[model samples]
Structures are given as structure tokens and as C-alpha cells.
Target: MHIAEGFLPVTHCVAWAAVATPFVAHGAVAVKKQLKAQPETKLLLAAAGAFSFVLSAIKIPSVTGSSSHPTGTALGAVLFKPPVMALLGTLVLFFQALLLAHGGITTLGANVFAMAIVGPWVAYGVWRASRGAGASMDLAVFLAALLGNLATYVVTATQLALAHHAQGLVQAWLTFMGLYAPTQVPIAVIEAIVTVLIVRALSKIAVPELQRLGFLPEPAQPVAQKVGI
Candidate 1:
């Protein structure tokens, strides 16, 4: 979900942009290093960004300035790691701001900080934790995407509360989150399922690519059978 144009105060917008700049900068370097090392991943990377763009573009109005939508960021975080996803997510938001008027250029930085940086890291962390606990890839991805989408809304709620804190920060946050919950929860569940399906499909077609990215392990060779002669 995006914070629409002119929805946020100018000072808040600048502050958020300043905070997000370093992460986006680091992400650019990470992306360059990744492509240089594994040029084969470019297509997959593009697909990840496209997936996020398409899903996130489906906005349902919620709250005052924000909306509710599935954030399709977990796939990229799982495949390329969170750093790479920061760039991809920001790019998707940027295009949507300019072309689709979904989000605003003024609010781009805040949106990036939430949906791009915080969301991907949360998703990646969930994925790693779930896998470490011996969960299957599909289950891990589902949890990662679900929790990541929720995390983005939490951050957005906090941002809104901070900007409009007359009723107090905690109360305002609760209000925003309560409004978002009805739409966002179902959307998060759907996003998680869709992310799992995408990961499974990619695993079949992009085994080598996934292997290179450390998302898939190499296959073991067959043992020789004893001769019966």
C-alpha cells in the first residue's frame, strides 16, 4: 500500500527520504555485485521486481492516506537476499508513483523504507528462521510473505501516527492498524500463498539459478550398484 501524494507533511517526507537513502545506495551496490558474479540471474531478478509491482499495484483504499495491498517482496528477498530487494522494490514504487499515480514522489522515500527495506528484511529473517526450524520451503515462504506484508503495514501505521499524533501516538497507530487489518490480513494470506506457488514454479524452471543464489542445494549423484555377474 502507498501513501498518496501530498498526504504527508513536507518535513516528514524529507526526513524519511534521508533515512532511506543509505539503504537504497547499498542495495544498488549489492545488485551490481550480484549481476557481475551471476549474470544469469538478471532475468529472475527482473521477474521478482515485476511480481512485486503487479501485486502491490492492486490497491484497496484503507485508512486516511494509505491503502491495503499484498506486497510481493518475499520472493526476491528469499532468492537474492534483502539488500537486492531494496533496490527492486524501490524501482517498482518509483514507476508506480510516476506512471500509475499509485503512490507519490514525495512519499516515495517513506514507502521505500517500509515496503522495500523493512519488508524485505523482515521476510528474509522469517524465511531463515522458519528454515532453521526445519520448516519446508513452501511453508517458510508463506510465513515470510505473510509476516512481511504485515510488517509493512505496521511501519506505515507508525509513520502515520507520528505524522498525525493529536490523539497520541499509540492510539493513532492502533486506529490506523485497526482500519488496515480488515483488508490487509486477507491480502497478506493471499500474498503468502501466491509467493509459495511462485517459488515452487521457479524451483522447477530455475533450478540452476536458484542453486547459484543458494536457495537450492545441488543434487547428489547416484551410488554405483554391485555387479550381479
Candidate 2:
């Protein structure tokens, strides 16, 4: 959900940009570490960027005369670290705004905060928590995707609330949440299912690639594979 320029007051835009600045800086540091550790990760980052660009551009019509698209941050976080995914997401949003006019330039910071930062960080946190619990790869992926999708809507609602507050609207936050929930909840469930299927397929055919990217668990006991086979 891209908030158009002029939709929010200048104060809110400045505030979000200020808050997001450190996140963008931390993302740069993470990208540097990833580059140092795996030189090939540059190519992977490029691919992720391209994939994110395409996925975000393909919008599905929604209520409110606006459209929604898969953030793709969860997928990237599952494949790489959240910081790197943030960078990829930022770049993708930048290009989407500049080239495609999919999102407004003035609201880029808000979009980055919501789709790039919130989604990836939530997904990463969920995945890490699940991993610590000895959850299966599929389960980890499912949880990450679920949280990511939900976080997107939450962030969007918060942004809309801020906008309404700036306009001196009554009960702005609650109103925004009520308006957006009807559309976002179903979309989140659909996205989670799609993410699970994609991750499951990748887990089966390209386990090594996932391992190299630090995305999947270490090989389970050999018997696990035999049972599936």
C-alpha cells in the first residue's frame, strides 16, 4: 500500500524519514558484511532486486480504488538476511516509483518503512524464533510469511492513522484500521499460502542453494528424506 505524495502531512513524512534513516544505514552495514562473507551474494542481491521489482509491479485491484502487490520482503528475508533484503527492497521501491510511478516519491520513506523494513524484520524474527524451537523448514517459512503479511497491513494502517491525525480527523487510527482490515486480512492469508508453496518447492529442489544462503536448516537425519522419497 503506497501512500501517495500529499496524502500525508509534511510533518509525518519528515518524521518517518527521520525514523527510517537509521534503519537504512544499518541495512547498508549488513549488506557490507554479506558481501565480505559471500562474494557471490552481489549477484543474488541483484536477482532479488529484480524479482522484487517485478512482483511489486504486478498489482491486484482492491477495494478503495487502490491496488496491492506482494511485498516480496519475506521471500528475500527467507533467502538472505533481513538487512540485505531491506536494501534490495528499498532499491526495488525506488525504481518502482521512479520508472513505473507505482508509488509516490514523497512517500517513499513510508513505503520503505512498511514493506521493506517492517515486513523483512518481522519475517526474520519469526523465522529465527521458530528455528530456535526446532521447527521444520516448512513451518518456519510459513510463520515468517504469515507474520510478514500481517506486519505490512499493520504498518500501512499506522501510516494512514498518522495521515489522518495530521488532518485533525477523529479516532484516526481506529478508523484507518477499520477501513483497511477488510481488504488486508484475506490478502495476507493468500500471500502466506503462496509463500509456503514457493518455499516448499525451493526446499526440495535447491536445498543446497538455500543452505549456502543461510536460509534453511542443516540437513536433517537421512531418514527424513527417505521417508519422503
**Top TM-score model:** 1
- In model 1, the runs with Cα more than 4 Å from the true position are 62-66, 222-229
Candidate 2 Cα errors over 4 Å, as ranges: 166-170, 217-229
Candidate 2 Cα deviation (angstroms), residue 51:
3.3
Q: TM-scores of the models, in the given order?
A: 0.94, 0.84
- lDDT by residue (tens digit), candidate 1, 112-192: 999999999999999999999999999999999999999999999888889988999899889889879988998899999
Q: Candidate 2, after superposition: displacement of residue 98 in Å?
A: 1.2
In the predicted model 2, the residue pairs found to clash are none
lDDT, residue 135, candidate 1: 99
Q: Model 1 has how many clashing residue pairs?
A: 0
Candidate 1, position 40, lDDT: 97
Instruction: Write model 2 residue lDDT over 94-207, tens digit each, in one string.
Output: 888888887778788888888889898999899989988999877887888878977877788788876778555557767776665666667666677777787777668766
Candidate 2 global TM-score: 0.84
Please give the clash total of every predicted structure, in order: 0, 0
